[model samples]
Target: MHAFKRAVAPVLTFALALAIEPALAGSSETGSGGADRLVGGNGPDQIEALGGNDVVRSLAGEDRVNAGTGNDTVDGGADADSIDGGDGDDRLQGGPGNDRIVEERFGDDRIWGGEGDDLIKANRGNDQIWGGPGNDTIYGGPGKNVVDCGDGDDVLYYQRAGTARRSTGCERKVREDSTIQGRVCGQGGTDDADALRGTSSGDVCRAGGGNDDIEGAGGSDRMFGEDGNDRVFGRFGNDVMYGGTGDDELQGGRGADRIFGGEGADHLVGGYGRDRLVGGPGDDRLEPGWGEHGEIVDCGPGKDLAVIGPGDRTRGCEGVRRGG
Candidate 1:
């Protein structure tokens, strides 16, 4: 009976030690060569799970995690964190801070930047990124990626080779000569001359610096030429074109349209349908031709003149000149 009691006592003590082991090791850790699980306590910690299918939870405070060489899962729980999902198909969540996540090659990844202005880069494999809030910047590389910038003014950069299926919420910068087949309604470009063309659906396209040529091809679209000397074409549907600054040219094609020349000497041409042209604040020229119907011209707060076409109608326009 005494020998039986001695064996039972040792078993009970071992179970107790195993229960307390996680609490003791919760502060910081480096994983072994096998699959491991590491959890951070309620303080700032640095964890490196090196070579296994590891699970890391950085509970609170600013933490840095490197999920090194296997299929892993990491949660950056509050405060600003930097997470690197190094070699396998991984899942990463930036709970509520401005986090930076980098996904390396091989295996598909799923990443979420919960709140704050986050930066996420998906280097390879088919990946998915969700920028929950704030103005985030996301880059999709190589594989087919789906990115949803949930709210705020965000920016997305995608490669030309792969398919980047993007939802409506962010400004997109497509590499030169690449086409976005889906419906896009955001600002385009940085300083490069971007040839932004829209899909058949109605789109709102905005251009940045550098001379840009934007075409609103099929649907009823709105084009805003923000800066530089821009040429905007509203190809098929009823469109609204705004030439913000610089010597700009606005073309309203097909259906009933409205064109505004914000600043600088702009040339506005209303093509087809009943159109309205407003020359805001510059020495501007307006051409409203009565093809099947008439057009309205409002030369607003500027030394503006209307080059009237045959059978064109002009109202509140100061200077009028006949166009041959």
Candidate 2:
């Protein structure tokens, strides 16, 4: 039983960039057929279409193809391809590439092979495909596909919540003194993912997911690998993490950090952050974060879910266990 409804792209509200595609916004196109070469102009292919080996080229600017109802072939040259599969599944590509493909209802589209292949996909209710960093693919099937194959040479990104998706264009607006404000709000300041860098080095963090292997570079940062099998680092900050439902490696760089194995069998670590770590219900290991967060200690799951340690006033898990 699949019930992942379609993602209604947020009206692009404050659209900073309306990527304009050459000639395709209004044009001479086809409905569905064999082979017709499409060059320039706006097209929903609102009707007339080319048969066998048809070539729809979208050169320069932002372009769209309603590639309606047919086993059609598309070439979005030097631009992003927004294709809505009406009936038959289609093949779409981003030429000179760095292309974006928005797959909607009605097609089991096979979108691939681009220079900069970035795909945001959702199936005809229950479709399957993957994104490509190096021959990547997106099977955004059985629901709303939210996957990002970040800077890497990988394939097939794992899906997650709408909160996990990244923003671009006007979607990402950063102010002076490092203030980020837009569709995705920052952590008070700009400590959230919207900004390239996080807040503090010795700060605990949960970098949102897609299909990535993270390293906590310089600071003693903590990381949580939720949703997919990943590799993480605690460069120099103290951190904690939860490898929720995936095979993961939680490595602390310089400081000590804690880790929790929620579902998947994994490897827990205290990379650099001097921290406490734990595993839920699987074959797992433990490690620590970078430096230290002042005598951090752990005593497993208390009757309540609170974790208070050594001389700390916080009395949730450790201090007030016999709830009365």
Candidate 3:
């Protein structure tokens, strides 16, 4: 642990160069309070750069390096090393070794684990990470992130809040639930299931081809369940929902919503307001919200069941179940 004082990065760069030059390789070194440039040797060494925007590099061997504070750049040059970027916006590199890199700061950082299996934990801020080769594990903190695990099996753990995470080349991705804002889209063209949600403002969601789940939270939203068995919820405001080409369940929660159960045996619930429920080409079950009136239920094709109320227009439904 080290006490850190914030210094201007531009001033520290000039002061560090005049104060200390590059040390001999393979030797243990410690930096001054100002921003310092510390270079490690071919053999194992310990480098601790306390305070300021320092640049530390472990050229070879198993090394331990810690950049205490300020915007720092640290590189684990070769072999296995443990590197920690203590605070501020940092760029960390684990170059060609099984390394453990930790960014415990609140800044937008960039990390690259270049070759060999590595473990990286990016704490707070919108981070960009690349796990280059070998099996890797990456943990992203709060903020929008772009993670590319290039070549090899990798696992990424992220959050599903308002932060947008774009991940590629990782074999497995696990998301922790948080409140969402705006639009959320599913992975199209793959049979991978996605959980999508919307915010208070009008949002759009397209669940493509997988067994998906969606929740439209508040506002007038447009939701599409493109394929597979899907469940869609329009929680508030006037919403438009489509269960496209699958056995789906749609709940229209409040407002004058339009819901369509397209091409499967589906269940539709019109939960209040003057709603329009269309069951297209399936043995569907349609039910209106409690104490609803002036609704339209059109069950097109197949033996469909509809629970209608007063002033509710119903056509193309084979069976009718009276509401209480």
Alpha-carbon local distance difference test for all models: 0.72, 0.42, 0.76
For model 2, the local distance difference test gives 0.42
- Segments of candidate 1 deviating more than 4 angstroms: 1-26, 161-164, 176-324
Instruction: List where candidate 2 sits over 4 angstroms from the true fold.
Output: 1-36, 41-55, 125-130, 134-139, 143-324
Using lDDT as the measure, the top candidate is: 3
Q: Over the stretch 1-324, how does candidate 3's per-residue lDDT look in tens digits?
A: 001111222333343344334445678889896878788777777899899888887777777788888888887777767788888888788888767778866888878887876777787888878888887768787678778877887878688443333677889886644332323642322355667877778888887777777778668988998888887878667999999888997877657899999999998877645789999998998976532587889999999999876778899999997753
Query: Who wins the TM-score comparison?
Result: 3
For residues 1-324, what per-residue lDDT tens digits would candidate 2 score against the true structure?
111111111111112123334453545555346545555654322223433434455555445555555665565555434444445556655544334454545655555435443434455543423343332223354344333343444334333333124311111211111122322112311223221223445444344543234444445454555556655544445555566666665544434555665665665544323456565655553322212334233323333232222332222233332111
lDDT of 1 by residue, 249-284 (tens): 786765798999888888787765678898888888
Ranking by lDDT: 3, 1, 2
TM-score of 1: 0.47
Model 3 alpha-carbon miss at residue 184, Å: 35
